[model samples]
Target: MATWSDFENAEPEMAEAGKKLLYQFGVGLAFLATVRKDGAPRLHPICPTVVNGRLYALIVDSHKRNDLRRDGRYALHTFPPVDVDDEFLVMGRAKLIEDPEVAEMVRKDQVARGMTSTNDELAFEFGIERAMHAKYPGGHGTWPPKYSIWKER
Candidate 1:
């Protein structure tokens, strides 16, 4: 597994495009897909955090959180645009951030941004396995948008 910083250092363009798509709305908004306990898929809206060259998401006490805790494997897709057919995706494994300092920093940032108030959230740093982006020049008219992909070696 490669950290976001590692991926960024290796494939700066791809990583930047992915990051742009993820935060296109000036905030973290994406569709997070995780495996449920029954081997099914669960999708949820998530606001991801990118700081200090790391991708993090705070999971509250909910089914989505449980899914991530039980199975770290996940797929995150950028939120759809109203007038564009472009897409960005990332697949990775999430590991809990056990370091108190790291977690506290993230928490403080979130609070400063008015994202969260309490520290009861679980912070997980994503380890990138693959990242990709598709750009459509003519919306759905384009059969296959130009695809750019990067995989950790």
Candidate 2:
């Protein structure tokens, strides 16, 4: 599996603007991955919000939802957009938290974004493993080794 050693050492946390950029234009681009009943990895996209280093998402009766219910193992994928056509990927593990107040807050945000109106959804916290950034546009600005991640040696 890919590890952190292969990537550049960004600070323990991203800059405030960088963090916000990941969420601003990344509403519908957040993806979740989990294991299916048969034990295969399944990936799905959903509306997501970040709070205190956790990613909260809502899905309507999705296969991924079932997978997450069966197993808390999941990941959140987000891309940070750049004006120079650059892309950054954040990879991490996730855990679902079932709290009425938290769920209600997420539901309210979802409604505001026109994503959903029900509070019957799941909330997750992702332990970010690594972040990889690369230049896009397929030109001289692109960097070598297209992408990398944080992993244990």
Candidate 3:
């Protein structure tokens, strides 16, 4: 859990640094998650997304999608290298969102980035729940990752 005071008083530059690092490397690593039915964790490589001031992913024809449709609960993890032996890990929950407009926006973004097929496979959005971050190499200092709680309208 995070407190408002923590994020509120954070240096603007520091927060930007952390976000840049995460966003830069968020695309490569597999997002580890668990579905509701079996409660078994799974992993999927995702293209990092920042939409409507929130983070999301356009999941296409994945079991993750099926799980999200059934239950809008999941977790994600990613590691981005900062330097030799210096890296950061992000863990968080994800919620599914289904909307035609949002789906179209995501599709356009994906196509622009050469990620998704132009077909009609788009169906869901994984909205962030709570994000936790930790840095490696011990002496790097600390600033807790920002966690976002989703409220679907």
Best by TM-score: 1
Candidate 1 Cα deviation (angstroms), residue 47: 0.8
The TM-scores of all predictions, comma-separated, are 0.91, 0.64, 0.62
Error of model 1, residue 49, in angstroms: 1.7
Q: Rank the candidates by TM-score, best first.
A: 1, 2, 3
Report lDDT (CA) for all predictions.
0.84, 0.56, 0.50
- The CA root-mean-square deviation of candidate 2, after full C-alpha superposition on the true structure, stands at 5.5
Residue 112 Cα positional deviation in candidate 1, in Å, after optimal superposition = 4.2
Better of 1 and 3 by lDDT: 1
Residue-wise C-alpha lDDT for candidate 1, range 1-153, written one tens digit per residue:
988898899889878888878877766778999999999999999878778988888878889888888899999899877677788888999988899899888777666655754568889888889998888888666767889898999
In model 3, the runs with Cα more than 4 Å from the true position are 1-18, 25-30, 82-95, 137-153
Q: RMSDs, each prediction?
A: 1.7, 5.5, 6.2
lDDT tens digits, residue span 44-126, model 2:
77676655444566655667777766676666555545444445455555556667787677677667665655555676545
| Model 2: pairs clashing at backbone N, Cα or C within 3 Å | 3-150, 3-151, 4-150, 4-151
> Poorest 10 consecutive residues of model 1 by lDDT?
109-118
Clashing residue pairs in all predictions, respectively, total: 0, 4, 0
Candidate 2, lDDT over the whole model: 0.56
Error of 3 at 83 (Å): 3.6
Quote the RMSD, in angstroms, for model 1. Answer: 1.7
Give the least accurate 10-residue stretch of model 2, judged by summed lDDT: 1-10
| Higher-ranked by TM-score: 1 or 3 | 1
